[model samples]
Target chain A: MRMLRLLTVIMLLFSVAPTITAQETITVDFYFPTATATITNPEAGESIEAVFNRYAAAFEAANPGVQINVVYTGSYTDTRNTIQTEIAGGGAGPDVAVMLTTDLFSFIEEGTILPVQDFIDTMPDGEAYVADFFPAFLLNSLDEEGVIWSIPYQRSTPVLYYNVEQFAEAGFDAPPRNRQELAEMAQALTLPDGQRWGVWLPTEGFPIWLFSAFVIADGQHFVEESPSEVYFNTPQTREALDYIISLSRDYGVMPGGTLSWGDGPSIFTSGKASMLFHTTGSLTRILNEAPFEVGVAFLPSGTAGEDGTGYGAPTGGGNLYLFANSTPEEQAAAWAWIQFLSSPEIQSDWGAATGYVAARRSAWELDPLASLVARRPQYAVARDQLAFAQKEFSAYRTIDIQGIINSTLSGIISGATTDIEGALTTAQAQIDSLLAEYR
Target chain B: MRHHNALGSRVADAVTTLLSLLWLSPLIFAILLSFRPPNEPITNGNIFFGSTITLDNYRAAWSVAPWLTHYLNSIIFVVGVLIVQLVTVTMAGYAFARMRFRGRDTLLLIILLQLMIPSGVLIVQNFATIRTLNLFDTHIALMLPYWGSAFGLLLMRQTFREIPFELEEAARIDGASLWQVLRHVYIPLSIPAYTAFALVSISSHWNEFLWPFIVTRSESVRPLTVGLSKLVATTDVGALYNQLMAGTLLVIAPLVILFMFFQRRFIESFARSGLK
Candidate 1:
């Protein structure tokens, strides 16, 4: 009796399997980082997974015979690691994944990603679609040959956050516009005996990020279109490094040694630091947590340009990339899913819900975000700063190169290495050797 | 001599207390931070008592992930791994300790060599094997690679060697079967070693992140560490330390409580087994 029952079940499975394959739905395994895990919409009170599920449901509803499996890969680093491991193991990874913008070169070098340009070329409004993105946000998405590899999604830039009441108390009606004024303002706002520092420009962890702002403001960028080159030992970068060290050692506005990136916002909110150089993604959190009024402004310029705008910031965020290990139909569905997520309306909603700057220009013209920005103008500062934003330092061996730069900067700033020029020169030499293969 | 010994003991007590406090500081900080008001910064008035304590962080952290499902998955994962590890290590240990076979020492040497390689380096190969086995995104995949622990096998083999051969001989003389003699004699004598290995295996697998995160996709299969990871935002976003600490506490609460309950027994087992 048991044998007969098992035989019937096996026969049933054999009959159903063929039909299931005949009408198989195209399933796109969408792996995304939990970048927005902490972001919650106050009005809707929806959790992060809920928001993701809603989007997936909407996309699937619009396109029949297609399914989206949303996998919450931990962080940007974890998502990239998972994908790399899967691809190296000869398994089909996620059909689509959101990874750090700086991962473009490595992914391309590994040949694991499908260039989204291939899909964009087939679109009727492809040119306009590509043009709609902020150029700063797209800076890291393109390869050296000018082929697009990814689409910008959650993006951000560092901005100057000041204590409004402290500025008023110091008799400053406006935020600093130049480096000199910034130094003076920070000094005035600072209290004696370490009660409060003038500013908390964090130089720990990835110090090169905020340091890039200073280098760019001084009329140079550390990296260019070439993935194998970096200008780490340039006069501009040295001056920037010197200026950052002087902020603590000479000007006595910031604490000596390396300040932690994780502690900046809390220090600012608690009035232990008067001004903070932090990502705009923390704007909402700061605005809510701060007891005093908060003010946002462009990072003060080191060298004023002809347009009276020398402000520069490095864009930092993740981008959507289509993986290569998928069927053509699945790839098409994944591309459509990407398009839906990056569409103007979705971007606007996403920007408003989280504090991330919307990558698309038209997203700011839409509802929730437009209204929110109108009420609180601080949201627009990062977007406006994009006009001077540069690509984040990325290269073929980005992680190893970043380690060299970060450790060099940390060593100099922390007073462990006083010879900035010599250290940077050595770093440049080391980076050259590392990137020689790519060249 | 008595006075001198008393002074020496007192000094040792002081040192031990200091060392224990050093170890406990992070947990202490986490406890304080988890109870802190959500918006209150640690740099306020006092680091410890900066603001009025509240349950808000716990409330918020609890809602971020499905803790119940994660708890179930974690329990299933650790228990499942421990069970399989116990059976395999016991059988393999007996074979190496007592059973005579061709090239036994060579095979034992090969198994012991795995202890030198870090598990992280084997992720690619293990993941491929799991994929081939069609166990991706399942709890079994999360537990499979860990089932044959080289450290446990070696420890068990050494432990079985330490047991008196007279005990097994007595059991065999009483007409006990091979399985009965091994089970009632060798197993009973090596309880301390088994307990130590069980604790080591359970805690390590409980806290594992990268392997489980790579293998499982759904919440139904992912462990508590993956759930805890959801509370961490990318570098672009600021850290929410209060809620993060709260989420961490929620994830590790079970293991911490279990250890507290079995604290005495754990120490005794480790002491007897000469394992730490």
Candidate 2:
């Protein structure tokens, strides 16, 4: 009886003890820029978590010594701010970060991110695989100093999403091919009883990309060879601004309540608006959730003498960056994960899973997705827009000045001051003041 | 006319009850949401209208972080803070009530000034102080700044003054020292006041998020408030809503249970202490 009781106590002790005594797993911290989303017991290839799980399983299976822990911090901006603070404080931050290349230049200048070329050079198949990505995607991933930094994983550009029913109602067989057609179609599409507008722009968050495209389309320069100095005060930019403003005030074809925090895509999806100018990444969301049939159109053309023949959108996507602080072995492991993730198969699978266009050119040739893209046909518009896309080369203190741009852009739309020159002047002055520290 | 008066009063009573319920509706919704499945999207249809519920949210909430550790750390923080506060406030209250000293009224007024100044503006300064003391990332860091509360001192002073001087005189006649007089008579009589202060201090510290989030880096030291933020940030409507709601429910469950357990004592102490 005594022996049995002693045995039972020993068993209890053994069961309660932590199992960290063996060969410790190499924990690689992966910081993802995403807000949490709930998908119910997700089906295979149907959700982001499902795709993440597949990658994690395959990576872990290949490299048994490694255990990757994913922490969904928040949106792109939130993760950038958090990482900045963490780096400043000299704490144990993420070993790897997968975030947008739109903010890459600023992060590189601030020295928050470390270049991964040296890590890539030591890899067996890195040279060939890295070459598989499009040049534009690679350029977006490069730092201002022309050093290779992050690897492009997922990328997209904005396309015009139009309501098919509204287009038919407006007596148009297809999406408008030019700005003049779009404007004329907008006038035709506007209905009194429906109160549905023709075109809608987000009053916040997306204005920088749209404004940058406008500046480029109008043949105006933001800055000379030096990325500093304000140059957005040209006549061409003023004309572009006037055109967009007229789309709202003169045409009365833009959705109302945009200035007061209403969603443009939701408005488009719910048939409150006839058209929405947003990312191709929104394609899957609109396809999955919108109550009406949707159509894709090229971004509007500018007036003559402007580079308005084609829409000049920026290539926006998340990149996989390996941290410099990681051990040589850990770096190798992270590279392996990155390579696995960026492969043609994975890219194709991920693109099909999410709405994002794959960074790889080879992904377009894959079956089912290839067929889908070929059939829907308009999905290929993102590829064409990619040719004109430009990445942002924000100043060293882009973050502090980013909020200023977002606020000032919103201020422009609300007609708060109605002075484009004054807004640009004040923005320039603010940017200059911010740049003083970096200088 | 009698029927009309009766009908009007009944309608008035019904409207008042409805208004009370309308005020409580959000709290009721939070309670219901706490039991929802983790990761389910909440829609308008579900907001005022769904009935399918489960305990998975509660279970997920329980498992999300080192909640047991958070609860233990919270208890330690509240008890430690309360113990130190009780001693300081009692002595300070006794001094303010009985002793006529130089700058006494001026000093009390200065202390009361702390109540007027918002706590938010002091965060950066408090963080610097906590850092200087090597108390950052510790439960003590959270408790230290709030240990000697001005509000508690003022309340205790009022309660002490309400008591007659005869109690202290009786204790003095028994050859009791100043310490003994405070310990035996004054302390015993001030139970209601101390209880009122404890309820407030414990609940506030238990639910505080920002200061704790700023100070504590590790999950081990974080309180329920900071832990719940992780769950909130994770809960996008299309994913993890159930888990977020579950975690929120778990965070409040202990406090709710605690409040219920001490509801009678809480009401009595507040009533006796005369702090509405």
Which candidate number has the best lDDT? Answer: 1
Q: Mind giving the per-residue lDDT tens digits that candidate 1 earns over A32-63? A: 88765865766657776777788999998999
Estimate, for each residue in A40-95, the C-alpha lDDT of model 2 and write its tens digit. Answer: 21223233444575778888898887887665445566567556655555555677
DockQ of each: 0.62, 0.14
Using TM-score as the measure, which candidate wins?
1
Off by over 4 Å in 1: A1-14, A17-22
Please tell me which predicted candidate would have the highest DockQ against the true structure: 1
